[model samples]
Target chain A: MNAAVEIDVKSEAEAFLIAEARLLDAGRFDEWLALFAEDGFYWVPAAPGQSDPLNHLSILYEDKSVLGMRVRRLGHPRVYSAQPAPRTAHLVGNVTAAPGAEPGVDCEVRSTVMMAEYRPGQAADRRLWAGQQTHKLRRTPEGWRIVLKRVDLIDCDAVHGILAVPI
Target chain B: MPDSIAPDALRRLVLPDRVHRSLYTDPAIFDLEMTRIFGRCWLFLAHESQIRAPGDFVRARLGREDVIVVRARDGRIRALVNRCTHRGAQVCQAERGNTAGFACPYHAWTFGLDGALNSVPHRQSLPPDFDLKDPRLALAAVPRVESYRGFVFGSLAPGGESLVEHLGPIAAVIDNVVDRAPDGEIEQAGGVARQEYRGNWKLHHENANDTLHPGFVHESSVSAARGDPRDYAAPAYDGHQTHTQMLSNGFGVREWQSLSLTGFPAGHSYMGGFYRGGVLSPDRDDPVWREYRARLVARHGEEKTARVLGEDRFNNLLYPNVSINAQYQQIRVVTPLAVDRTRVTAFCFRLKGAPEALFHRAVRFLTNLSSPASMILSDDIEIFERVQGGLANSEPEWLDQSRGLGADRTEAGGRTVSAGLSELPHRAQYAAWLRYMTAAA
Candidate 1:
């Protein structure tokens, strides 16, 4: 690929990541869900070097269906964890991309995301979650849909308090 | 017991069918519990499979004392106090690994797998009277360490009940878990998922066998799952088991009351299987279940396999710390961190000789139920913290555990059976708590 085309791929990936962060920040989980392909998954591994979500435990390993349940639960009125829904600001940076190995794929986009979550109360709970995200993109006629989005938190193996909102 | 907490005063905190809120809120009481209850109890440490080979070790907590559970070269498992005997620095820092010996970071005081002081940085600098062979110089070993069916437990108290006596009839629960394995063995698979909650450790145990709270506490996930429009008919559908498991929590009042709840005097308790229709149902006739059943039958024969597979119980709480779910092959170990904080570490087991897919399912179950981000446990933890927050007020000095009190009946064994929604488990826990708190020091 020429320099202009390479620059275009990088810019496109950066734009997609920024837009996705905005959707999460705005609590537009439905729109975020739409960004995932039908066969796509969202994984947050518990261990740093965890490879297999099937055989290993993870903080989260949700396919679209499970992620749908999560989204629904987040919206449910009785969801106590989200009673005072946590406000999150996802800051994306350090963008890098590589061409997909398989056919019918665009590129694999990698970035660093630091999500600042604040649960409102007299004694508010504020947490800064920093993680590396790997998003495999597929260039469809409509747009780039995510095939896999993996987040490896800095404290992947640490004993975590309730993660009310996604990082 | 601590000087601040008298035996009589501690005894008063736990009555026949209620306990004082201070038991959950007072830091002094929490300190007493670390010694009187946790110090004396046979707390579940680690599974044998985790330290199968010599030199393999895992870090564990016995009350507030950190210890290294290591298998020595001689094939003996020892729980060594992680502190260096010299300067009290932690000897081992890693969570789990294979190490020949532990070297203190502060001073290179090496301790063997058996916690024997093997070497000092500079022996020549020590006084002539400083004996290296002195027992005081070695890392302290837990007073007693024992294993039952690959489940290792350590007791800080020097001597009390034998491992069998401590387990009482609950030993059968461990047997049921091991016997479910096709090759009559199970290994700890998948990594551990640790979650911290702002509540007393006892809250986790009390809620483990409480059937009535699920409908109210997990209404969010249950209702969401009920409203889910996604198709679940696909064979081997991914994540459907979690959906069904969440739905199981929506059991009706009558249905929750119908299931059996049994509590032992030792504080151990369990509830009869409630997942009757879901993919998590032990009797589900699916490919994975069918394959697992075949493997069990191959080893134990038809009748034995039927007996093994037929046995179904959930959240088998073994007193102060551990809760086991044999059917799902998971265990959650509770560790008290402070008066109002606790940590729970969950691990999944792979049934030997069974299909790998079954283990994968177990992994999924562990994640969905215990992970930090779990939809179910997040609610439970929130309630625990809320309960702690509510207990901060002194208006209601006592909390009730009297549900199904008069209705409970004693069965053939030492077990007390009651309706599924009964708070007998909590009462039984406090009964044991009172006994431990007031016992002669």
Candidate 2:
């Protein structure tokens, strides 16, 4: 590819990731769910450098449909864990992009993210989650959609408390 | 600590049907439990499969002690206190690894996999009376390390009931789990996912067999799953089992009451399985089920396979620290970290000869039920923390365990059986707790 094309892809990927983080922080889960391809995956592995989501345990490995259910559950009035919804600030930076591996794909984006979460009226429940994310983008007729998004937490194996929202 | 809290006073705190809130809030009582209960009980450690080869090790916790459960070169498994005898520094720093010996980073005091003190740097500088070969200079070994059906357990107490005796009739549940394996063996697969909650350790065990709480506590997950029409449609999605598992919590009063809840003498108990619908159902005729059934039948024949797969006990609580779901090939090990905090680590097992997909499904089961991101488990954890917060108040000193006190009946082999919604397991647990707490040490 030409240098101009590479620069465009890199800039586009960075913009896409920044927008995605904003959607999560804004609690627009339904709109966030629309950013995925039909068979897109959202994985949060329990261990760093974990490769197998099928044979190995992950904190979460949800396909698009499962993500739909999660979005619905977060909106439920009786959701005890989210009774007082959590407020999150997602900071994304250090982004880079490379061409996608397969055909009909755009590029692979990698970015570092630090998410701060605080539940209302529970100051002690505040948490700061830091991780690196790999988003595989595919160019669809509509626009660029995420083919796979994997989050690798710095403290992936740590004994965690309740993590109700997406990181 | 046990003396600090009088036996009679402790006994009074646990009546026939209710327990004092202090049991959940008092640090002194927690300390006593660390000695009497956790100190003496046969706590589940790493499985043999995790450290199958020589020199393989996994770090585990025995109450407050950090232990390394390792397989020695001589084919023997040993649980050694990870602390170095030289300066009380930890000998092993990694969670798990394959190493011939552990060398303390502080002073290079080396110890073998069998926990024998191998060598120490600057030996000549030590006093002449310092003997490297002396057993006292080596890392301390847990008094008793035993294995039943490849499940390793360690007890800190010098003398107590054997592992089998501690398990009692609950051993049958272990047998049923291993028997379901097509190759007659199961190995630990998938990594462990851990979650900590701000609640007493007893809360996990108390909630394990309580059937009534699911519909109330996990109502959000259940209702959300019910609201998803695609989950019940003819063409199922990839997360069909995940959705169905959550929906299973919506089991009604009649369905819950029809199941059996049995408690054994040794504070161990198991509740009958309730996932009898959708893809979570054992009788599902999917291709994966067909393949698994064929593999099991190949090993145990038709009738035996039927008997093995037919045993559907869920949440088999082995007293103080372990809960097993044989049907899902999952185990959740609970560790008490403080008076008001506990940690649970969940692992999945793969049947040796079963299809690879079966193990994948088991991994999914572990994630859905035990992962910190679990919709079902987060609710349970929220309730646990809320209970801890509520109990901090001085009022309502007693927590009820009387739901099924009079309904319990003793059966053959000294097992206490009750209705599915019964709190009989809590009573049985406290019965064993009082026995351990008040006994002559």
Candidate 3:
């Protein structure tokens, strides 16, 4: 009852990440939320290479509760900032996996990505947003889940415009 | 519409109760403000902690000039224009770092931490008549730079009010923030939350003291925090609460009545709505608050510290650029990029000698209340952007600021007192704006 199954960890991981990006880019937040482990972390460090979020400030640091609340706000019609939502796109690649930090998981997925965001922004009427991202993922029994996703912006120190949406 | 900014024409844009929309969207008006307002006023640079070590430097901007705020080898802080005297190229490109000195990338002309010309590359190329001691030869220093406690500020005008004189009543907020620290000092903690908005810089400046829209704009957040976020039928907080919570609004005949809007001379104002006994109560078993309060009692004694700790000031706008929340240990700086674009950077401070818990709590408050994820900030930015968009149109030529006109009463100490939700802050700011816009250069 067993067929030869060739499991390419990198390919699966890449597919998982591409699917995750698709969910986000399409504004399918609820589906994206399902891709996170129960205690997953969505962190955008305030300082470059910042280690801890509790002690230091973060642009976005959310546990399940906070992430849920933000998602809820994003969906609310009266969410003023969301009336005309900031649109974004993600391009994920360089996928690699290592042993998972959790006991009963396959491995952690690491990747390099470039994302562009726009909210009617312009310097000379040019719409743009750019950043690099790192994601730490784990493979569960059913599907891959994100444990930690870190976004490092080129202008991390510069004043930001409407990071209200997920980066 | 005449192109000239004559005294009468400038004054007409700003009335006692309303302001012309062009004032918020005109590039000409923005350029004039760069000269008459920002150039003449004391603008915040960086906290002392930013440049605590000798040779540590952080870049800053005043009006549109790029500046480097550095702590010199002698431990004195200095601000120097980034323009190279040789070819006018920027001498330093980094935002902040520890560096021995800066050397222009274009040419090797170097300057010391104190901004003196340390050396020039290929000095033999220069003529023998060059006078190194000439004031114009070295880095062009800002006309006036001063520090109060740990906050540093700089002014571009050759002659104007002293930093302290310019601070006026707004000075008290800084003092209280530093004085409340158990060690009588505070240090910048965590990183800054840098937010950019598509709106006039003045909108963020005025929003600090504009307390009327919270109930309407932040309605979603209130319900989310307390009830179901999707509870569309839920009414806004309406500044009402249970009997116990009513006391928090202060003398709560009406929530608005509980707040006292005060305006001061030279364009400064505050919205006082902080509950009595302060946002942090000493009675709580919270370890950080307990320890913090004990230290205050030990140094300042019980009775005095109580009033100091129980200070009721909520939002303090230090005219032109900075908004401070001493109670929550926050300092927000607003930078104007263009007529309709601005950036706001916020920092949370740690009260020295307090537990790390206090630092965490401060960070938590900032995250929930002002971080980019915050609905409060989002709503405010949305409104600001909408206002900016609306002002770009000519249909509504004037922004109605007559919310509480003819209701201001002169109080002592150059203060104009008004009831709740009055347009006192806008009035106060416009008065100063007109004076500066019309003053002789």
Which candidate ranks first by DockQ, i.e. highest? 1
TM-score, chain A, per candidate? 0.96, 0.95, 0.83
* Docking quality (DockQ) of candidate 2: 0.77
Q: Candidate 1 residues B1-441, lDDT tens each?
A: 475767887777788778999999999889988988888899999999999999999999999989889999999999999899888888887999999799988979888888888888778989989887899999999989999989999999888889899999888889998999888899998999998888999999999889889999999899888988756667534538878878888888988898888888888998885654343585666787888888888899999888877777888999889999888899999999999999999998999998888888899999899888999999999889889989999988999988888988888766789888899889888887888887776
- Candidate 2 Cα lDDT to native: 0.88
Model 3 has a DockQ score of: 0.42
Q: Score the docking of each candidate (DockQ).
A: 0.80, 0.77, 0.42
Q: Candidate 3, residue B218: CA error in Å? A: 2.2
Which 10 consecutive residues of model 1 chain B have the lowest summed lDDT? Answer: B273-282
Model 3 — TM-score against the truth?
0.88
Show where candidate 2 strays beyond 4 Å: B231-239, B276-279
- Better TM-score candidate (1, 2): 1
| Candidate 1, residue B163: lDDT | 88
Task: Assess the local accuracy of residue B365 in candidate 3 as a C-alpha lDDT between 0 and 100.
Answer: 57
lDDT of 1: 0.88
Tens digits of per-residue lDDT, candidate 1, A108-146, equal 988999999998853278899998999999989879998
Evaluate residue A15 in candidate 1 and report its C-alpha lDDT on the 0 to 100 scale. Answer: 96
lDDT of 2 by residue, B18-119 (tens): 999999999999999999988989999989999999999999999888999999999899999989998999988899989989999999999999888999
